[model samples]
Target: EEVYASQPDGFVDPDNPNHVYKLKKALYRLKQALRVWYDMLSSFLLSQDFSKGLQISQNPRGIFINQLKYALESLKKYGFESCDPVDTPMVEKSKLDEDKEGKTIDPSHYHGMIGTLLYLTASRP
Candidate 1:
């Protein structure tokens, strides 16, 4: 029921030039397509008694936020399984400066570790 008319026969095959295809779906070019699709999906969910979940932001509607699963997976992936859990990510007196005298590990691997820790801060902080 949300179908719209598109430009007529612009690229139709010459043998089938007489045929006019009716569009039954939304297209990216249409300004209202996203809104219409969202409204339609929301309406269907509501009709089935599924209430909208809490919105975490206003710029985009209907977004849900949760971090438990991500944190658990990160802990597993980083081999923290047997290690003792620390109350704080960083120690009170610990310094995190680049160790100029320490044996250098692969820059890519170090950067990857730093990236994961940085992302964890979003939830842990």
Candidate 2:
């Protein structure tokens, strides 16, 4: 991954005043570097028998990695605890319809909902 930085004061070459420096080494703040760090840490955690309880994907083979309390807490934290329950997760009849005339939702709120759902999947084994 490419990383860029501008030369600090007194370090800039006077002949190339408009030039910016390209980073050759992976910095701790870079996104790719952070991902590598996270992978290493997660690998270490898994090696120690710690599961990623908040992960979204489910594993088969009848493993009982329940996160019921975590799911409940997440729902409450996202203000869904008192909301009316749905018999089914989605309505098949509305699958093809686009909400062209419906009120617009905040993008941040929509992302928050997705995040909560992903976390809620931890309870599913």
**Candidate number of the best TM-score:** 1
lDDT tens digits by residue: candidate 2, 18-123: 9998987667867788887888999999899665665344468543456666667667867888888768777667757688999987899889878868756644
For each candidate in turn, the TM-score is: 0.38, 0.36
List per-prediction Cα lDDT, in the order shown: 0.67, 0.75
Distance from true location, Cα of 66 in model 2, Å = 3.1
Alpha-carbon RMSD, candidate 1: 11.0
Quote the positional error of residue 124 for candidate 1 in Å.
7.7
Per-model tally of clashing residue pairs: 0, 0
TM-score of 1: 0.38
lDDT of 1 at 43: 99
Off by over 4 Å in 1: 1-21, 28-32, 35-64, 81-84, 88-107, 122-125
- Distance from true location, Cα of 62 in model 2, Å: 15
Which model scores highest in lDDT?
2
